[model samples]
Target: MTDHGPQPVERQLPTEEARDLLALVRDLVQREIEPGAAEEEEAGRFPREVFRLLSASGLLALPYTEEFGGGDQPYEVYLQVLEELAAARLTVGLGVSVHTLACHALAGYGTKEQQAEHLPAMLGGGLLGAYCLSEPSSGSDAASLRTRATRDGDTWTIEGTKAWITHGGIADFYTVMARTGGEGAHGITAFLVPGDAPGLSAAPPERKMGMKGSPTAQLHFDGVQVPDARRIGDEGQGFAIALSALDSGRLGIAACAIGVAQAALDEAIAFTAGRRQFGRPIADFQGLRFMLADMATQIEAGRALYLAAARLRDAGLPFSKQAAMAKLFCTDAAMRVTVDAVQLLGGYGYTADFPAERYMREAKVLQIVEGTNQIQRMVIARHLAGAESR
Candidate 1:
C-alpha cells in the first residue's frame, strides 16, 4: 500500500534558528520515524532507540533551560516540533510529551540543588520518564487518588497502584504523586523515584486499542522507598503541581491531535486523487472534495488553537482555559477528520491495507487521553462560570 505522509506545514517561527530546528525535525521524522511507523505499530514494537536518538539530538530537551542540558526553546517552537513528530508517529510524540510532564515538578518547584543534580540527565541523558497521578479509581478526579506515602525520618515509603501510566515498565524514572496528609487535593505530595527502586514493579502492559507501539501499563508501588531529597516542593503540593503540568500537557495533546488529523487528511487526499470512480477520479466528485476541504480546515483550525494556547503559556499568562479548549477542539476535530478520511477511502479505509483505518483507531484515543473531551469541557465551563457551587 502506498503511504501518504503529511505535507510540510508552513510554520511561522520566531527566529531563523527555530526554522532550522523544524527543518531538522522534519528530516529526522522522514528518515527515522515515518518510514517504519506502520510496521512497528502493527507489530506492537516500542521504538526506544528512536527516543534515545531524539535525546542525543537535543530534541527531547527543547522548552527547557540550557543550563541543565536543555535546548531553551519556547513552548511555541516545542509544540510545533511535537506536531511534526506526531504526524509521523504518535507514540514518539506523545512519549516526549509525557517525559516533559514528568519533569515539570522538578523544573518548576524543586530546589536549585535538586535541579542541578537531576535535570541534566533527565532532560538529555537518554533517560525516559513517566508521570504518575491517576490510579485505578481516580483518573478524571485526580484529587481523589489514594496512593499513600508514609514518611519516616529521611525516607518515604510509597504503596499503591498507578494505572494507565504511559511508560510504566520502561521508564528510567517516575514522578509520582501520593497521599501524604489528609483527604482531598491538599493531601498529596510529589516524589521523584528511580525506576529501579525496590518493591517498584509494573504489571504487564495494558492491551490497548491503538498506539500499540506505546506501552500503557499499571505500576505497583509496594513499599517503594524515596529519599527526602527526592521530594518536590512542600508536602501537600503535588496536586497543584500536577494540575500545572497538565495545563501544558493538554496543549501537547492538542498539537498531537492536529498532527494525526493532518496525516489522515493527507491520506484521504492521496487516495481520492488516484482511485478512479464510475467515470473519473474520486477527487473530482463535489461531495468528496467538500469533505476533504472540511478536513483540511479543521486541521488548520486545531493547529491554530494549540499554538495560540502555547503562546499564552510562553508569555507567562494564564492559559489553563485555553489549553482545555484546545485539547477539546483539536481532539474532537481529529476524531471527525479521521473518520471522514476513512469514509472517503470507502472499504479500503476499513482494511489494514490502508493507513486510514489505523488513523481512525488512533484518533479515537486522543479524545480519551490527556483528560477526556468531556473533562475538558468541564474545565472550560469552570473557567467561564467560575467554580461550580457546592
Candidate 2:
C-alpha cells in the first residue's frame, strides 16, 4: 500500500464497521453541527454542545487506542471523520485537530503512568486541549522559542507567554514548549501545563479574519509550577515530540482542507443547478462546468496525497515530506477551489447568502497555521535534496 505520488485509486469504500461509523458521523455532523455553524461563526460563539456531541460520539478520540476509552481508528479512517466534521463546520474540525495534536506528546511519548492518568480525560472528557508551541517571536522557527523552564527540585517553574494558542483559555491542558537549555532548538522542551495551574492565565481572544467560533488567545505562564513527571520526554526531546505530533497534525489539516473544498464544491453544484440565469440553469454552461470539474479533480488529488502519507505513517515509515506535501497542496487547493466557488455564485457568494464566503475565509487560516505553506515547501525541499543526495 505504497503511493509514490498524487494518483488516486478507486479502491473499495470503507468496510461494514467503518462504513457504519462513517454514516453515524456524517449524520451527526450534518444534523448537529451544520445547522448552527453559520450563526455561530457570525455571532463568534464556540460550539460547546457540538463538542459534547462529538466527544460522546467518540469522534474526538477516533485515532487513539481503545484501551483508554477511544475509538481506536487508523489515520486513514480518522481523517475522513475529520473531513466530515470540517465540511459541516471549519471551527469544529480545527479544534479537534488542535486537541489531538496536544495529546500526541503525552499519548505516544509519555510514560505508562502519565498515559494512564491523562489520556482518558483528554480522549473523552468535557475538557478540551491546546498545543502551546508557537510564541510571539518564534512561530515558523519553533525551536527559537524564549519561554524559560527552570528545574526546581521535584517541580519545574515555567515562565513565558505562548502565543496563538487554540482553545487558549478553554482547554483543560496545554502541551507547552519552553526553553529549558540555551539558545537553539535543542534547548526547548515540552511540558504538560494544566489550564488551572497557579500562575497560568490567558489573554482575551484576538480578533481574527476568520474561524471566530474557534477562539485563539495568548497564554501567560507566570512562574507556573509543573511536576517533573509532566515532562513529555527527556529534556531535549520536546522538539522531536512536537515535530512528530505535527506530522500527524498536518495530515489532519489536509483532510480538513479537502472537506472545505468538498463543501464549496457541493455548494457550487447546488447553486449552479438551481440558479437559473439567461433562461437556462447556470450549471448547464460549459465554462461553469469546466470549473466544477477542476474543483473536483483537485480535491481528489488532495485526498490521494493525504491518504498516501497516512499509509506511510501506518506502515511506520518516514512521512514528514509526504505530510508537508499534503498540507501544502491540499490547503492551496482549498483556497483556490473555495474562491472559485464564491466567484461562481457571483453576488450571493460575496454575501452571507452562501457558505462559500465562510469557506474562503476558513481556507486562508489553513495556509498559515500548522507550519506555513512556506515552511511546508522548505520541508519538502529538504527531504527531496536529502533523498537525491543519498
Candidate 3:
C-alpha cells in the first residue's frame, strides 16, 4: 500500500497564524515523522530528535504564555497540531502531551520566581519531562499513592516508585507527586526533581503491544533529595494540581484518538478504491461503501467532540465534565473505527505489511491511558449526579 501520510484535514482555525501553524505542522509531519515511523516503531526507537526539533520550533509550548518562551496559542490550536502529529505517528503526539502535562504544575501554581527559573527551558528548551503520579498500587485511585516525601531543613527526601511513567528513563526532569502527610489525597505534595538526581533511577521499559517507540517504565525515587524551593503549589494541594492537569491531558488523548481514527479511515478509503474483487473495484460494493461512510462519520464526530471540549477550556469555563466525555467518546470511536478499517482490508489488514493492525493495537491503549474509559464514565457521572458514596 502506498503511504499517503495524513490527508490535509479541513479545520476552522481561529486566526491566520493558527492556520499557518497547522500548515507548518502538516509539512513537518509529512517530511520528518511519517516516513520512518513504522520502521522505527518496529525497532522500538524513541524519536528524541523529533522531540528536540519540536521544542526548537516552539510547538511544544504552544499553549503557554510567550513571556516564558511559549507560543501563547489557545488549546484549540495546540490540539489540532497534536492531531496532525498523531495522525502521522502517535508516539510523538502523545509524548508532546505528556511533556505539556509535566509542566502544568509549575506553569499554573509555581511562584513567579519558579516560573522565571524553570518555565523557559521547559517550554521551549530542548529538555524533556515526565509526570509521576500513578503508582503500582494507585493507578486510577491516585488519592492513595504511597510515595512519601520527608522534610529535613531545606531539603525534602522522596522515596517511592512511580509506575507507568511516560518518557521514564529519558526525561530531563520529573514532576513528582509524593505524600507528605497522612493517607488519601490531601497528604500529597508536588515537587520538581531533576532526572539525574542522586538516587533517581528507572526500571527497564515495559514491553507493550503498541507505541513501542515511546517508553513506559517505573521510576524509582530512593531518598532522592529535592530542595524546598522545588515544591509546587501549597502543601497538601498536589492531588488538586494533578487532577487539574489531567482535565487538560484527557483532551490531548481525545485529539490523539481522532488522529488515529482519521488515519485508519484514510487508509481504508484508499484500499477500497484500489482493491478489486469480483472483476471490479470493491469501492462499488454498497456494503463496503456504507462501512466507509460510517468510519468517516465517526471520525468527524470524534473530531467535533474534542474541539468543542477544547473551546470550552479555552473560554475558561469548567470543562472537566466535557473533557471526560470527549475522551471517552473519541477513544471508543477510535477503537471501533480502527477495527472496521481492519475488517474492510480483509486479509491484508491482519498483516504487518499494512498499518491497520498496528493502528488497532495503538487504539487499544488510548482507552486505557490518561484515565481508563471506566474512570472517565465515573468522572462524567460525578459531574452530573454528584460524587459517589464512600
Candidate 4:
C-alpha cells in the first residue's frame, strides 16, 4: 500500500454554488438514501424512486454542462457528491457513476449537434444510461472487444453482446464501443443507441455476489440500428474515449470504496463500544482500539486518494495514473477494513444482522470493476515505463 504520514485533511476551494450543491446532496442522502438500503439489497430490487429523488435534487446531472439542464459542477465537486451518495447506498452510487461515464462519451467528445440531440435527455430526463465496452472475451483487455458496427447507408447496424453492463435493460440509452475497422484498439468506435431500437435485447441479470440492487446483464445488439449522427467522436477514437471515461469512473469507484469502508467502520465502532465482554465493552481493549484506528485510517486514506485524483481532473492535468491508484488503493483498503470489521464482530458479522457482511461483499466487486486492481497495477507500471517498453 502507498503509505504516507497522517496528512492534514483536504480542504477544497469550491465556489458558493458548489458548496450549496454538496450540502443539498448530503441532506438528501441522510434523509432519503440510507433508510432503504437494507430492504432494497435484500429484495434485489432497483430503487427507481431513489433515482427520481436524486434527479429532482439536481445530482443526476451534476457532471454535465449547464446548457444541458445540469449543474455544471466541477469534477472535484461532482466526486464529492458521489462520495456522499455512495456512503448512503452503494448500488445507487454505482448506477449514477456508470450513467455519468456513459454521458462522458457524449458530453466530452461528441459534436455540438450530438450534444444538443442527446445531452438534455441524458442529463435531466430522469433516465439512466449504460456504458457497453466489456464483452465476454474482453474485461481487463477492453481493446479486444468483438462487438461490431457496420455502416448501412446513413445508418449503422450494431451486432454482438456486451457483458457486465451496469444499467443493462433499464437504461434509455447506451454508449457502446464496437469494432468498426480492422483490429486492436484503433479499430473501435463508440455509438449512442436507443435501448428500444429494433434487434436490441438484454439478458437477465447475472447473479452477482453484491450490488444486488443494481442490475448487471449482457446487452445484445443483433443488427440494432443507429443513425450515423449517433456516433461519438471520429472512428478509431472510441478506445481513447473509453479509456478517458474509465479514468474518471475509477475515481467514482474509489469514492464508493471509501463510503462502504466508512459504513463498515461505523458499524464496527458502534458494536464494539456497546457489546460487553469480560465485564467491559469490547472496545476498551487496546487490540480492538488499534483495529478501529486502522479502519478509520484506511477510510481517510481512500478518501484522500480519490479526492487527489479529482483535484487533478479539476485542474486540467493528467490524472489517469492517480485515478487508477485511487481505485486500486481504496478498493483494497475497503476489502481489508470490512473483512476485519466482520472479524471484530465475530459470528454476528458473518450473519445479516449487521451491514458489515454486506459491506464486505460490496468491497470485493470494486476491486474487479472500472478495470481490476491487476489492470490498475499494469496501468501504473506502464506510466512508469513510458517509452522504455522492452
Each model's lDDT comes to 0.93, 0.88, 0.94, 0.86
Better of 1 and 2 by lDDT: 1
- Cα lDDT tens digits, model 2, 255-288, are 9999888888888888888889999999999999
Q: Per model, how many backbone clashes are there?
A: 0, 0, 0, 0
Model 4 stretches astray by more than 4 angstroms: 1-13, 388-390
All candidates: CA RMSD (Å): 1.0, 4.9, 1.0, 4.2
Better of 1 and 4 by TM-score: 1
Using Cα atoms with residue i matched to residue i, what is each candidate's TM-score against the true structure?
0.99, 0.95, 0.99, 0.95
Tens digits of per-residue lDDT, candidate 4, 94-213, equal 888998998999999999988988888788888788999999999988989999999988888899999999989999899999999988999999999898899999999999998899
Q: Per-residue alpha-carbon lDDT of model 3 for 294-317, expressed as tens digits?
A: 989988998899999999999999
Which residue pairs show collisions in model 1?
Answer: none
User: What is the TM-score of candidate 1?
Assistant: 0.99
lDDT, candidate 1, at 280: 92
Cα deviation of 73 in candidate 3 (Å)? Answer: 0.6
Pairs of colliding residues, candidate 2 = none
